[model samples]
Target: MVAQLETPILSSPCRVPYTVEGLLQVFTGSHRSFFTNVMAQALRIAGQGTPVLVVQFLKGGIGQGHEHPVRLGQNLDWIRCDLPRCIDTPQLDEAETKSLRDLWDYTKEVVKAGSYDLVVLDELSLAIKFGVISETEVLELLEQRPRHLDIILTGPEMPKAILDEADQITQIRRSHRP
Candidate 1:
């Protein structure tokens, strides 16, 4: 039944909105479901024009290891930012801290280059929770983001400041099944 429903969405052409509000409207429900739909739409739109940079937030390999499911009519340059390989917990070793800094620097450089159409920062809330990435750094990135660039930051517990600045914000709550 699920496969049957997804077939049509997967087969349909990509049609993503230009505005952040429109994009938010497209994914108004649960995080997993919203992300799946958003990625599909982003991939479809990306195929039509320039490449996209997808920065996936890593949190125990949620949503299939940062790789977008390859469905028909999907096209986009997906770049996954898994963060420092080490230091799974909130407390990080010296090396892990350095690596985290390196990751942020690399991301800044990429955004400055203005090459990608979209950049998905996945599991950013975890970074904040663990003190891996500072809110200041995120704010700086948002302020410096290039025009026409689409940035998607996912995960639970998003900062109030970031949410305020976001053009679109979607909250995914847990659902209990019998």
Candidate 2:
């Protein structure tokens, strides 16, 4: 959902900003058994020669995750939003609530700046699901973001709007073995 603004005529020809191709990758599952692998692959492939940012909600780092210990590259940037560990049970005091909003604002700034080539919104679905941030707000930010910016959103219970807007969607479902 890209918003097109009216181009202002300049006395001299205005320098047109370089339009970069962007893609959104969505990953959802109750059990992210392959979250790290998918994330690592994304980083390994797209993260080269450009900056990558990971905004983690609930868990801080790869090591902090409950699953396998995932190793991150040196150049990757990490921003952890302190949300309740479980979406089913959210415990947020006034301070944490403020912090979550602050983080959301900060993420908007980063995305708007178009500084990073790739950005991963880890567990962002949970944040939206739990009302930490509104889906409409996020959608607006995404719409206004630079074309060159590529984004990846991870977590369970992704909204239909998000899924609809995503270029690619991966659902990692855990099967019940007989």
- My TM-score estimates for the predictions, one after another, are 0.64, 0.75
The count of residue-pair clashes in candidate 1 stands at 2
lDDT of 2 at 110: 81
Please write out the lDDT profile of model 2 over residues 1-178, one tens digit for every residue: 1212334555666655444478888888877555696567556744454667777665632233222223356556666654444334466667566666777788889899987767788888877877879999989988998887788898888899999999988999877899
Estimate candidate 2's RMSD in Å.
Answer: 7.0
Model 2 gets an lDDT of 0.70
lDDT, candidate 1, 51-148, per-residue tens: 55555444323232233422333446554334335234687667556555665677778777876656666666667778878988888888877755
Model 1: lDDT of residue 164 = 77
Which residue ranges in model 1 land beyond 4 Å of their true spot? 1-35, 59-75, 81-88, 175-178
lDDT of 2 at 72: 58
- Which candidate comes out best when scored by TM-score? 2
The CA lDDT at 122 in model 1 is: 61
